[model samples]
Target: MSERREHAEPFPDGSHGDLRADCERCFALCCVAPAFAASADFAIDKPAGQACPNLRQDFRCGIHRDLRKRGFSGCTVFDCFGAGQKVSQVTFGGQDWRRAPRTAKQMFEVFAVMRQLHELLWYLSEALTLQPARPLHGELRLALDEIERLTLDSPGALLGLNLAAHRQGVSDLLLRVSELVRAEVRGSKKDRKKDRRGADLIGADLRGADLRGANLRGAYLIGADLRGADLRLADLIGADFRNADLRGADLTGSIFLIQSQLDAAKGDAGTRLPPSLTHPAHWSPGDRKVGPVVGA
Candidate 1:
């Protein structure tokens, strides 16, 4: 998952500090590198490699305060995991696409590769922090270090990377970590059925369900009613939570839960989250009735 630009309190040791996006250090790579279709998420159809019309000369979104209202909700949830800044300042040596039009195409290509590599770094960094996954920490660290080095490769080298194969290797390791961590939660043999990996739960009414230790990786949970659900120790990697109702849900110990997922869902102040995550500003301070789930 990409990094969000929201202001969050840094980890005490600041180990994952660079994993978060620093828009000020970036040259608006996200606005120019990716193609955007006119959809519920984006207000306009934008071709790849072209800067969004809303992008300002200072590299800030012109509708920053009213992106959603202006039909650019998609822009608000995108997080490059610091890839924009890394590509702008490190890969290209602080040269922006506008300043070096000849290199703009190559820069956009490298940004794609760099973003995925940085995402792996984010997941690996989080895996190391899970005490239950201590046995795999050494492997995770080595992988993280390797990917971190790859992010520093020259643009040509970055573009040549076998990203799919590399991502699969790292994904296999993360699955192992997920299993190790989820094993800590004692559950009845019947509860083993909670292995809903890649389950199609779209628009399902799952209010107050006991999802503890559930393997929900890649589950399509769009528009699901997850209010007051116990998601502690759940493996939520890649779970589609768009429009999911999380009001009063307990996710404090949920594994692999990221901010982008929360940003897309509806939550209230009563939603309990991991210490590493912050509540989305759009979440209501108190409980509000959620509308009926709309089909994807």
Candidate 2:
């Protein structure tokens, strides 16, 4: 179990505190906290709070090397946002749930809450770095501090946290940041149509589209032809990117896009990502080669 979270993008300049998953300090909370169905994502069904069948006694995945081959492809894309380590080491004081069965339920519940808080931290950290969002830096800093504080609270305090309320407040600020960033995009009148927020564009033919600063929030872009599309500064929060062809697409400076969104899409070396994100290792050259741009 490597101490790396798939969704935890590093701070661009290494100035901010770490949010990356440190599995070395974790007790495999992700393998036990969340429930999984015997579907395309998992080989077998496991209820919440139950240890995964592949979990070893030492809190490591028995099939970590070949998880995708064994029908756990979804696990490869999942990120706990450093919640596992925080729960195991800090919150529980290095006490393993197996050694303290009485605290297992509360531990799992708190782990879930911590994961949410950590996720908010991940996005907030990125939002604070955006040049267009400089005006909201103070608000972002406050939100980050509050969320980080919550993550350090006792298990009971975490369980009692109003997660929904906090998320809503942060979300409103993020929306404002998106609007400011997108408004700065200079494009022709035809390019203005690319602002398709919450559009049902599943499998749309958007090849070579100049979608700079588009409001693509919550858009269903599964299997969309995004080859070489310019998505810089686009608000991609909640956008469905499964099976989307991102080969050669420029996502530089995109806002609120998470690693899970990239993991679900097809991209290659030609895909340009933000400074904080690393390209998915699973993507291969054969998945989606760079093709000719229809309108460049």
How do all models score by TM-score? 0.93, 0.89
Q: Lowest summed-lDDT stretch of 10 residues in model 2?
A: 287-296
Instruction: Report every candidate's CA lDDT.
Output: 0.84, 0.81
Model 1, 154-231: lDDT tens digits are: 999999999999999999999999999888674678678999999999999999999988999999999999999989
How displaced is residue 129 in candidate 1, in Å?
Answer: 0.6
**Which residue pairs collide, candidate 2?**
3-23
Write the residue-wise lDDT of candidate 2 on 1-296 in tens digits.
33233433356577444467778788888888889999876889999999998899998899898887888877877777778888999999999899999999999999898988988898888888777789999999999998888888999999999999998998898888888777777466865877788999899998888888888989999989999998887889989998899988988778888777888788888887775666677776543322222222
Residue 210: error of model 1 in Å?
0.3
Residue 257 accuracy (lDDT) in model 2: 82
Model 2 CA lDDT for position 112: 90
Model 1 bad stretches (over 4 Å): 1-12, 286-296
